[model samples]
Each structure stands twice: as structure tokens, then as C-alpha cells.
Target: MTTNEETIVMTPLWLAIEENLLALEGQNITEENKEKTVQKLVGELDGKGYAVSKSGIKMMALRWALEDMLKVGRPMLKDLTKALSELTLEDLANPCHASYRVTDNLGKTWERVQKTDRRDALIQMFEEAKLDLLVQKAKGLDGDLGIRLLIEETVESPVILERMGIPQEKLDQVHADIAAEIAARNKVLSLLETVEGKPDHEKVKFLFSNDIPEDLIIEVAQIAQADIDKAKKAMEEELKEQQRLAEEAAAKKKAEAEGPALEDIPMDQMAEHIYAIREIQYFSDVEKEIRTMCEQSAIPKAIVDLSFSDPDKFDELEKQCEG
Candidate 1:
């Protein structure tokens, strides 16, 4: 091969990866896109007279991405490590502050937060943790080998094997596992749909809430011959509009039912009507409003007094009223 020809032929798959990344513009990773990327790499390599397998090229591209992540994440990882080491047990147990700070690739700083009960310090640093460990281990290896290591060491499933073109040793076993996973996923879908009487929009929301795979929702829709676009539109747009309309209708109904302004009512009539408060179907979330209305009116003094004397009872009433 001529010098230019050899250079072109030897060019790494990272170039293709960079192009794909640029095209994606930081979009969420998807299996379809990844497959298309591999096919594109295959075509590009073919055009350059390089006879590389799609799987092999994919592995190289994956490694390149990981390498970049590791490089960028190292500083963040170090900062996190230092901060974590310095943290006292009490800080981990119950943080008083809203958030702490960390520096990123651009030397721009951002706060790391752990929300009450819902988020943990370690959980918030997951990206940094994953990149730090994987990159540190793969740094010494070549692109293909590094990606192989990542696949082996990580919790990522057999789909990675298919993507990397790594042959499954127990092919039948792999098939069985895949079948089981699909069955389990289907069971989840059925339970969410049939048992719960949830429509596709709500079902999709449930799946998303559980962090179930988007592909599974797509698959479920396909199996049922449901229009995925319509289901998505209902969840994203139609359902939201319906909810908004319902809220507006409820507000209108409430206003109409409120009868006359309290100012228009005679004090004796208002006192007589205040007995209707005892018939409240459930406790209300409008705590401040309830408190003010009760406090200013002598007729509802019992409810206001209950808020101070037996606050737990009032709290229980509030809990029971939740939708």
C-alpha cells in the first residue's frame, strides 16, 4: 500500500466514533442508534479498503468512548474521593447543608446534592464512580481488549456480547436467559396493564418510574398492535392536556359551589353554616388556609384547637385525605 493508503487503512475506529458522537449531539444512547453506527463504521472502513469486522470496529469505538469518559472523569473522581474521605460519618448520616461542590473538565464547579431519603451521596456520584473504575482498569489495554474488559467486569448483559460480536459459549443457555428475561418483562407489563387497569399512558409512566427499559415498552406496544407514536403522544401531550383541562374544570366547579362570599353572609348565618365543616369528606392540604379560616372564625374553634392540642390526630386526618 502507498503511504497515504496505509495511513487511511490503519486509521482507528475512534474517527468514526467521533463523527457519530458529533451527529448525536449528546443524545441518549439507544440500541438502534448503536447498531446504525456499527453499520456506518463497516461501510466507512470498506470504502477505505480496510477489511475490519463490524463487531471489532464497534469494540474499538466503545473503547474510545470509555477512554474519553475515563480521562474527563479522572479529576472529578479524585475530587469526589478526597471529599468522601474527609466526610465524617454524621455528614453521611444526615447532611444539614443543601449541597456540596465538585469541579468538572472545564474547571467549572457544580454542587453535588443528596435529597432527603430519595438520593444518597454515593448515588449522586455514580457517573464519576463508574468511569473512574472502568477507565482505570482499561487504561493499560488496547481498544478492543479494553472494551472486552468493560463487558466482562460490568453488570451489562448479553446484549453487549451481541454488540461486540463476542461469541456466546453456551449459546442455548444465552437463549434461555433471553427468553426468561422477556417473559419476566411481559409479566410486569401484564400486571401493570390488566391488574391495575392502567391505560398505555399510565403504563408507560409506571415503566419509566421503575426504570424499565424503553425497548420493552416499544415491544409491548408492538405485541398488542398498539401505535407506539400514539401511545407516546398520549403520554407526553394528550394526557397532559387532559389533566390540565380536568384541573381547570375542577377549579371552576369549586368556585361555583362556594356559593356567596363570606363577606356577604350575616354573622349568625355564617356561624350556622360553619357546622358544615364537620361533614368535610376528608382533610385538606390547604393547611395555612384552613388554619387562618378556623382561627379567625369562632365557630370552627374546635378544629383550630385540635391542630394545637392533638397535632398528630390532625396530621392523621391530613394523611387520610391524600389522593
Candidate 2:
């Protein structure tokens, strides 16, 4: 064959030997054993119908190594070596070209070429490493709370959800469910704050006053109750001191102040004296005003009810109505 044809035919053999040499480096094969290893590799390549000589292999290895050392920086070489060190036999089975586009810290773009098999193996290893990191982060979280957080993160990022390979319909459902959960939790928290100093029965009544799901309300209430118990226990001594002062102040006021005999009045006539009754009256008046406004604006009662139940839904309905 001509010299040009000979060079073309010999290139692949040289590259194969170089790859094997790199693999040996990765394995940490001792220098004393490397010659035998390369000789054996030469035999295998020769058996495969390649024209390989020991001296030719040595020349190619030295040339390729020098070229790589000259072209690549230390950090990049270290990373490449580390990646090669972790390769498996299976990873080397399917050979293809894999192109990489990366940007360095100095904003310089670098295009690195890799074998497809190696790239796939690295991707798999990276995914597993990320999973391990996530598990470590989730170690102390309560059961499924960590998973819920992950789902939330996935739902928030459309790209992540798409990459997860979940069906579009399922993703939509998850998004809806997470949104409802967040809204319900926020509503529960708002109600809890509203009834912060109220009795448990009053708190339950106020929570039920909103159009929240019974199961969600119960769950949030239980969690809030636990937090309330912890806080109350911590403030127990302070509360006792405040109670004693309140009682002393009340006794002083009772001795010095005079008031009408409202206690002698009939229960029905004493409605204004009851705070619960006053609250009911106030809400009833507000409801009547809302109804009047709805009727005057020709708005449906359903829309008004939605406004009370879910302001978000009501706003959407209002926009549709306007449209």
C-alpha cells in the first residue's frame, strides 16, 4: 500500500493501543508490569488482524501521551484521568463519538470529545451520585416529607419534570395537587393565627368556617396543636405569673368599680353582652351586604359563594365573567 494508505490503516491501531495504555494507567498497574501488559495487548491486537509491533506501540504511546500532556492543562488532565479511572468493561463495549460543550470559570468555552460509552457511563454515575446526595440531605426529614419537597421542586421547574419522563397528564395532576396542598396549608395557618388565643373549640369552629377539606383541616390542626402545646409548655411559668396579676387586678376593679345589673336581664335580651353573639351578628350583616351587592351587579350566587370559599377561584370566575 502507498504511504498515505498505510498511515490511514495504522491510525486506528495506534489509537486502540493508546486507549489501552490509558486504561492501564487508570488501573494503577505498576511500571514493572506495564511492558508485559502492553506486550499482551499487542498480541491481542495482532490476533485481531492488526499489524502491531512492540517498538511501534511504544512510539505511538509516547507520542500520544506527550501530545495530550502538552495540549491539556493539569486540572483538565486530572479530571479526565479520574473519569477514566472509574470506567468499567461494559462501559467500553459500545464505541461512538460523544461531543461535550463546557464553559470554564473564565467564561472560555471548551469542546471535549469522548466515546459515547464513556459518556453514558459517566452520566449514570453522576445520576447515582446525585441520588446519594439527595438521600443524605433527606436523612433527618420526617417520613415522605423529603419526597414531597422533591416533588415540589420538580413541579416548580418544568425542565426538571420533563427530564423525569413523567407523563404530561400526570405532571399536570401533580401540579394541581401540590398547588391545592400549599393553598390549604396557607389557609390553615391563616386560620390558626386568627384564632391564636381562642379556645380549642372556638379554633375548630373558625377552621370549619372556611371551605377547607375536613381531612386537611384535621391534619393541619393536629400539627398546629402540637406546636401550640410545645410553646405553651415553654411559657407555662410566665403564664402563671400573668394569671396571678390578672386576678389581683380583677379583684381591685371589682371592689372599686360599679356597673349595671346586666346579669339580672333575660338571656335573650343579653345577646349584646355575648362576644360570640356579636361576632355572629357582624358576619350575618356582612353576608347580607354581599348578597345585596351580588344581586345589584347581576352576579350569580355561586360566584358570591366562591368568593367566600376560595378567593382565587372567585377571581378566576370574575375574570371569566368579565370576558
Candidate 3:
């Protein structure tokens, strides 16, 4: 029969057996129960016209269980081999069980009892699953930072990539590329720091002189200009505050030298001065003293006019006070 025709005929049988095996998952199969379970599977397969023996059913079940265990992660080979040895089927199976050999990723083979072809197929499946997981992890990572972390991990545990099938020459090239990129980025950062507070043109010139990339130079220049703007604003505010303080000091010194003007003196003190001026003997002396007091006291214009027009009003006020 042709390969395609055989595949079509065998497909349904494989599916039926797999369905029955799935039902046995999570069951506590012991020495007493294992033979009965295997016989039941054999009978089921026989009724389906495949006619597989009890031993064949047990081996298929063990292969299915091992495949399931090795699906997601790096399962230890020794653990798997130990579990294989402890199975109830191991005690019941024929002496050919001792011929089984399991080969690990490290090229170390453990001799046990299993068919060569089946054991090699399972080992291949495990390696493929591990490679698929590595690919998924790689797909999730991105950007320079992601690349840096990936490079670091590859350097620390190179076996990880080696198992992924990466060659040494390719790995060396990747390392060279990473080093060049890191060196360029560090140079840009150092140049940015050195050009701080410099004029925009000077910063741009300095970056160009260092042979920095145009895009990076633009970015760093903008940063430098922003810092300059911030410093200028701070200096302007400080200068304004200093000018205000200086003006206040000058005004205070002037006030101390000249004394308080009449407007600055209290109204009650102005009243006292006016009453004392009225007590001067001569009219001329009273007028002169009143004018002099008005000039020094800086009293209102209305009060000054009233004092000159009717000097006796203050005399009347003094008499009222004496009374």
C-alpha cells in the first residue's frame, strides 16, 4: 500500500487508541490494576480491528505519559529514567525492557528497556519543544535594552543559545555588534554631559566635532538649550530681587537723614505744634513759626491756609486745653 493510503487507514486507529489512553491519565495504576487496564485497552483496540497486544498497549501508554511530561519545560533526564524504572509495567514487561537506552541533550545515554526508534523520537520531541520555548521568549523581547539583556544572558549561559542551534561564529559577530552599539551610545551620553550649559550653537558644534550622529546631536542640543533657558530665567529673577532690595535700602537711608515729613508725623503731634506756635508773643513771630512748622511738618494745605488766615483759632484751642 502507498504511504498516503497507509496514513489514511492508520490515522483513525491511532486516534481511537489515543482517546482510550487519555482516559487512563491521572489514574492510580498499581500492579493489580495495570494488567487489567492494559487488557482492557488491548480488547478495545482488538474490537476496533487493530488487534494490539497488552504489552504494546502498556508501552504506548508510557510513551504518551512521557511526551506529556516533556511538553513544557526542561525535565531532568534522571528523574524521567527513575520514574520509568518505577512504573508497574516495568515489573510486568518482558526482559527486553533492559535494552532501552535514553540519550540526553549532553550526549550522555542511559541504558534502560525501550525500543531504540521510540526513545530517539521522544528525545527529538523534547528538543523541539525546548527550541520552540526559546523562540517564544526571543519574540517577546525588543529594543536596545532587551538586546542588552539578551546579550548578557547569552554571555553568562552560552549553552542556552548553543542548544538553540546557534553557531560560535554567529555568536561572536552578535557580540561585536552589541559592543559597537554600546560604545556609540556611551560616547553620545558623555558628550551630552560635557556640553551642558553651553550655547546652542557651541553645543551643536561640539557634538559635530566629536562626529556624533545628526539625530543624537539635535537631541542633545535641545537639552542643552533648555538648561540655558532655565538658568537665564533664574538669574533674571535674582537680579530683580537685588534691585528691589537696593532701592528699599536707599529710601530708608534718605528717610533717616531728613527725618519724618509732616505727612508722616501723626495728626495729634501736628495739633500740639500748632498750639505751641500760637503762644509766640509777636504776630510776626507767630506767622514765622507757623510757616516754619508747616514747612517741616508737611501738614495739609488747608491747615496751613487756616493758620495764616485765623491765627487766634489755635489760641482759643490752647485756652480750652488749659481750662
Could you say which candidate leads in TM-score? 2
How many backbone clashes are present in model 1?
Answer: 0
lDDT of 1 by residue, 1-323 (tens): 47855633343444434443445444444555656655665566566655546366566644455344334533233444566555443343323231233223223431222223323434444433444455455556764555555555553545445544456664345556656777868766665665366566566666656666667767664424254455566667867898999999998875554445545655555445444344331455466766555444443444445555687875665444441
TM-score, cand. 2 = 0.30
Question: Model 3 residue 242 lDDT?
Answer: 100
Residue-level error in angstroms, candidate 1, position 140: 15
How many backbone clashes can be found in candidate 3? 5
Supply the TM-score for candidate 3: 0.27
Sort every candidate by lDDT, greatest first: 3, 1, 2
lDDT of 2: 0.50
Q: After superposition, how far is residue 245 of candidate 2 from its true place, in Å?
A: 42
- The candidates, ranked best first by TM-score, are 2, 3, 1
Q: Which stretches of candidate 1 lie over 4 Å from their true place?
A: 1-180, 188-213, 220-226, 249-259, 262-323
- Candidate 1 local Cα displacement, residue 297, angstroms: 6.1
Per-model TM-score on C-alpha atoms: 0.24, 0.30, 0.27
The lDDT per prediction is: 0.50, 0.50, 0.53
The deviation in Å at residue 184 for candidate 1 is 3.3
Over the stretch 1-323, how does candidate 2's per-residue lDDT look in tens digits?
Answer: 25655643333543454455454444533457646665676676666556566466555644444344334433233454355445343333322211132112111311332434335544443444444444444444675455455564332445434434445676567568778888889889887898898766556555656765556656887646554455445457667999999999997765333223433434443332232323443656587775664454444344345457786864554444445
